[model samples]
Target chain A: MWDTFILNPMINALLMLYDFLGNNFVLAIAVFTILIRLLTLPLNLRQQRSSMKMQEMQPQIQAIQKKYKDNPQKMQEEFQKIGYNPAESLAGCLPLLIQMPILIGLYRAIIIVLGSTPQSLFELTARVYDYINLTDLLPISNKFLWLNLAQPDPLFVLPVLVFGTMFLQQKLMTPATKKQESKGKKQQDDNPMAGMTQSMQWTMPIMFGFFSLQFQAGLSIYFVLSNIIGIGQGYYMRRSMAQLKEEQATKKPAVIKAESETAVASPPQQSKQDDAALDAAMKGTPEERKQYQPRKRTSKRKRRRR
Target chain B: MYAAKRPLRRPVIFLLIIASYLFVACGVQTANTNWPGLSTDGEKVYVAYGPEVVAYDVESQSKTWSFPAETNPTLQFFAAPSVQDGRIILGDFGASGGMLSPGVVVTLYALNDTDQGVPGSIWTNGELVSDRVVAPPLQVGDQLFVGTANNFIMSIDATTGAKQWEFEVGHSIWGQPAYKEGVLYLSSLDKSIYALEAETGQELWQTELSGALASSPVVNTDLVYVASFDNQLHALDIQTGQEKWAASAQDWIWDAPAFADGVVYFVDIQGNVYAVDGASGDQIWSQQLNLPVQTSPVVVGETVYIASGDDLDAENPQGALTALNVADGKQQWQKTAPGPLFTTPVVVGDSIIVALQSDQDLLIAFDLETGGQNWDYLPPQE
Candidate 1:
């Protein structure tokens, strides 16, 4: 099932791109990565929008939790009034989850496509489509610049670039850290999600960069190109989201109400707090923003005691 | 809510690491890179496949001795061992000491074959080359010639394991070089045949073909025949590296054409067997088996022995050894094997020895006359 649906199609598509791109495998990889990023643009945009909305609702959410601290059911009703659902925050990870399969599939494809050994060539031939004219394409050119696409880079150039580009992408995607928040609030906001994302910003890049040391140079090229495309996508999403926030801030009260009803409905009384929360969410660190989030469930005994 | 979300953080990172490792392993692990290399010297057969090379006695029908008493995971032996006198010479795929080392260091081992239990290396030259030796080493007198995957052919002192001279080619050499009349003939993936001086490693002449030559050139009286990945069989002038005649095939011709009775017999990877006149390159008879053939057909008496693998698209892939009449390409007899037969079968006395990549059997022998099983040998796994 994996081969027929994911591997075969990807291999063929890559071969077609190779054929069309003057048989330059590096160009084929770069173009293919860009196309894939474009295809997933919608999901990325949706995830970014969800993050922005969640950031804007932080202060109001904190206020509701404080006002209804003793009344558990009343707090739940107020959360509904503000149209805040904690589950929507998980959507921020959806786009990343979707990319894992693509990475695995493309890795397999590159290995076989640039295969220099007889067994790998035989395996490639078996997976190739009938129309590809594999006879003419028996030996794919694997050289580009100082790299033999089938082997790892000897100069450590690609690995460094992979690390640098991935780190930049992670930086762009992660919410800015808030440096001005009180130490107590910062401690309270040290949630797992924030900590995970922060550590991932370093760990993910370092891990992939380490892998790039042993991975084929062709795969490393893909990693660099894909990370670049991701960085571009993040930039584009940030610009559009900022523009949307600006438009929302300048809108009339009736227009804002209509838009809020369709999206995450916000009470008029909390407008200034929402603005302050948005600023903190957009400019502060993920850990700082996470401090305002309410716990999902409370102990029944604690509620009964209250 | 944050605390509940915290648990997911560790698991996500752990899963990502696990998945990355799995994907990296799938890409980096050495799977089937090449087939087993087989050679025989009348009394015993030498098989080099994975980590070790073993010599099996033909008459005793028992194992004689295996090189390298203990298998080393880093070293792989796939090049056929060239046996001459009491010396067994072979080259390894290559290995390195992890990331600290820059490139792989391939070793050329010359072992004392007279050892009855496990042969010890007489001398090993590991510091000379940094590439995989795919082609079998050709030893002439006290000099040994080896072709590597890095597109270089080197001449070493057979007795001292000292590098004498080296010559670079346009591409990797996968076929054994044929040495005759003080000239060494090599076929390369650069789609050319190179003629180098046996003693000095100097190129006398080179003839460019339309496709890569993956098999060694068979030097006859005046012409040397080579099978090409260009789907053609070419006979080149042994002296000047001039093309004499070319015969076309339906697919890539992988092995060198077997010359017998003024006829050259060869098979393409698409399983098309052909017999062409040696002098004129005119096709005599063509037979289509429509399977995957990578081994050269060996002509013995009135029959030609050909080995082929089953369709790779098939669920349970198998292989077959078919004997065909030399005159008309008529099927005389055929026997099936549990795995793919990629190595060329060697005729030792009355038995044709076939090496397979199968787990159940590594080497199988059949009666050359009747195509009946003589014996099968499976090496002990590490």
Candidate 2:
């Protein structure tokens, strides 16, 4: 079922591209990867929107965590109220899930198409569709620059490029804030999620680079090209989201200004002591403010009990 | 609400990445060590699989001896063993520490009939070539000719295993060399057929074709028949190396065309059989079997036997052997096997022997007239 639905179709498409591109397997792989990226652009856009929404809610989520430090269940409820569920935010990876199989299929297709050995070449003949003419493409000249498409690059240039492009894509996809960047080991220990995220950013690229050094150069080419496209898509998506946010902010500035004025005005009508306490709470650190909150509420409850 | 489960996502992503790597690794790291070249000399049948060459007695269908006596895991053989003057001559693709190595030198070994390794019988031993040697060595008189992945054909002294001469071509020579009189004919992936002096390795004449030639040239009298990757078979004059006529085939021809009784019979990789007139290059008859054929057809009297495999079933390929009438291309008899037949069938007296490309049995002999199974031989498991 996998072969019929995924592998065969991918193999045929690659072969067709090879035929159309004058029997150059390298060109075929490049074009096929681009086509795949373009085909998944819609899904990727949706994923990017989901990611942007999560990024936009990070500050509110941190505030909620600080407010509910003493109430674990309330913290969960507050996270739900703010629509900040990390698990649901991971739906952004759906596009990657879809492309993973295609990437693997493309890798196999490159090997089969290159037909390095006699046995592999015969297997290629079997995989070829009847409508596709592969006679001229037999014994595919895997030569592209100094690398043989069938074998890995001797100079390790492709692997380095793969790492470079992938790292760039990951950086663009997950933009860390300046505070997170300046944070030391102690800060990372305090926020375990931040540490894991930072580690994955480096680890994934290095692992892929290692794979590029081991697998055929043709596959590495796909990886590098695909990452570049992903980076471009990420940039575009982020830009479009920023533009939309800017437009929305522009349309509602007066309304936001009115709300802020009203909030400030209401605090002064509570009482002199209450106004001073509110000012101190607003100026204090998150931990100090949370401590101040429980003390004020406990005093009021004790007075009510007496 | 699901933020509490965020800790589990990292491990899941890690597992998915590992799974993707494993999936691609499995597909890319397939066994590239097939193409078991088989040859027979009436008394014994020699089969080259992986690195070892085993000889089986034709009558008893029992193993007689194996070259290198002790098996070496790294050794790989792609060229069929050529028997000449009580010695088995074949080429080795050499060994590598792993698949990532930039390939090693190709060695030609000459072993005696008793399976004893001859002293100093390794020609160009440890000598690095451009690539591996997959073409079978062609033995002529006291000299043996073999082509290398390095795009050079070398002539070696059969007795001393010393290099006599070498001829450089435009591309790698994957097809075996054909000898006639004092001239040798060889085809290369460079889309050209070359004729050279067998003794001096001097190029006499060369003819350019439309596609790369993967099959050895069949030299008969004044004409040479060769198949190419361009899905066409060209008949060339032996003296001038000029094309006499070219017949179009359904697909690529990877096997040499068999000539018998003024007719040439061959099959394409797509299992299309064609019997063409050797003199005029006119198609006598063409039959489509819808299976992939990598082995050449054997002609005996009025019959042409071919071996084909259902390539879709990669794990357990089913092979079909069909006999066609050489005169009219009519089906005579058909037989099926559990595995694919990648080696050509050999006719021994009244029995036909075929080697299977599978894990279980290596060889099976059938009665030529009745198409009945005579016997089968399975190699002892390691």
| Candidate 2 lDDT tens digits, B283-307 | 8999888888888899988889998
Measured by TM-score, how close is model 1 to the native structure?
A: 0.83
- lDDT of the candidates, in the order given: 0.78, 0.74
Could you give candidate 2's per-residue lDDT for residues A1-306 as a string of tens digits? 777788878888988888789878788988998999889988888886776566544434544554555788977875775556877767778988998888878777777776656776777766778887676655466677777676666677887899899988876766453235444343343333444556667768877876775667888889999999989976876677668756866887754343223211111113445545534744676443323321111234456989
Model 1 lDDT tens row, A1-306: 888988888888888888998888899898888888888889988886776576556545655654555788977876776677767778777987998788899988888887656556667877989999766654577779988787677687988899899999987776543311222323223333345556688778877876786677888998999889889877877787668757865865554443333222222223455545544643566444433332222334656999
Which residue window of length 10 is worst by lDDT in model 2 chain B?
B115-124
Tens-digit lDDT track for model 1 on B1-382? 4335556777777788666655444333333267899998878999998888889998888888887887776668898899888788989887543542323557889888873777867799887775678788888888888998777888999898989999988767889999899999999888889999887888899998888777888999899899988889998888888888999998889888899999999999889999999999999999988779989999999999998886666777788999999999999999999898888999998999999988889999999999999999998665
* Native A-B interface contacts kept, per candidate: 0.16, 0.12
Top DockQ model: 1
- What's candidate 1's DockQ score? 0.22
